[model samples]
Target: MADNLLELDTPVIAILRAPTAARFAEVTAVLQESGITAVEFTLTSEGALDALRDCADFAYPIGVGTVRTAEDANRAVDAGAAYLITPVVSDEVIHEGYRLSIPVISGAFTPTEIHRAWVAGSTMIKVFPASLGGPDYLRALRAPLPDIPLVPTGGVTHDAAKAYLDAGATALGIGSPLIGDACTGGDLNALRDRALALREELK
Candidate 1:
């Protein structure tokens, strides 16, 4: 499954971090038209798993984010998530994801954490708060560990998306920049536009 996911080489994972989950479907509908097929629902959001279940059958992949525990991983898997994402590297969650055959994107910053996450069986590494280091940071990480796939999250805008990818990021995790106010305000067209524009840049 991890290989299958990598093969998708999805340009971005549209992230929803709202306090409410009602708009999951709405945002998804708009993103779908723009060819944004990978989405992540943060556990910090209310009813995150419920939102996942609601859209489990969608044509795209749905991932659970902010997963910090084995229980969270289990719940996310039970909710039918295709993959799991963590804000911090959690070996328990990574092990759980491995057992479930679900890819876990463990978050890390320093080279030590990133390498540790990879050595601990993380399916991939997420460079959290990636904006602080930006593409240059990723370039540095890739210098010694070019084989480990990295996913950059936080402060990754459409304009900066390609730079990270070029720096060796296997994919991106775009949050509000992708979701924007469209989820709550029902202006999903904004998200559609962003998604479409991003796809154009990535392509």
Candidate 2:
């Protein structure tokens, strides 16, 4: 992790992953209006790099997720991504993000993997598929790894946001539960509603 890691202004990192980024601008705008400042543009989404570049002047921090390769990390950095996120603990990806002076939110599940990722220099450990073990699982992990910041991702619903935070999550990575069909051209008003509700829940 770099000394200048992207600050998490909000607890939720809104994940926008769809077939394409055609709705990115609209979705992001609604999220911002709703007070959700952190966004993750997953490379798994088509045209994500170009979309990220298009948001060069976006008001908030937008990171690139699902980055598994160094080349992808470089491309994302070039595209103006504020940070990087990986699905698993990949030292290559972590090192590339470090070299680029970008923070990497490395994903891990087990306690060992979590510690390994932190040792590998990830800015934060994303407890992927967090729904599998839920908040109690996070609480257990925090018992021993109190110093490491954790961000629970995957199936993070608005209703469960506070529970995760209370379980020691530094932040959250919310996808479909918060996004719904917004990124796929669903209703922006509905997206705003969800964002607002989620933000309020966190508060």
Q: In every candidate, how many clashes are there? A: 0, 0
Which sections of candidate 2 miss by over 4 Å? Answer: 1-7
Model 2 — which ten-residue stretch has the worst lDDT? 1-10
Instruction: For candidate 1, write residues 61-96 as lDDT tens digits.
Output: 688899999999999999998899999989899999
Q: Please give the lDDT score at residue 85 for candidate 2.
A: 91
Model 1 off-target regions past 4 Å?
A: none
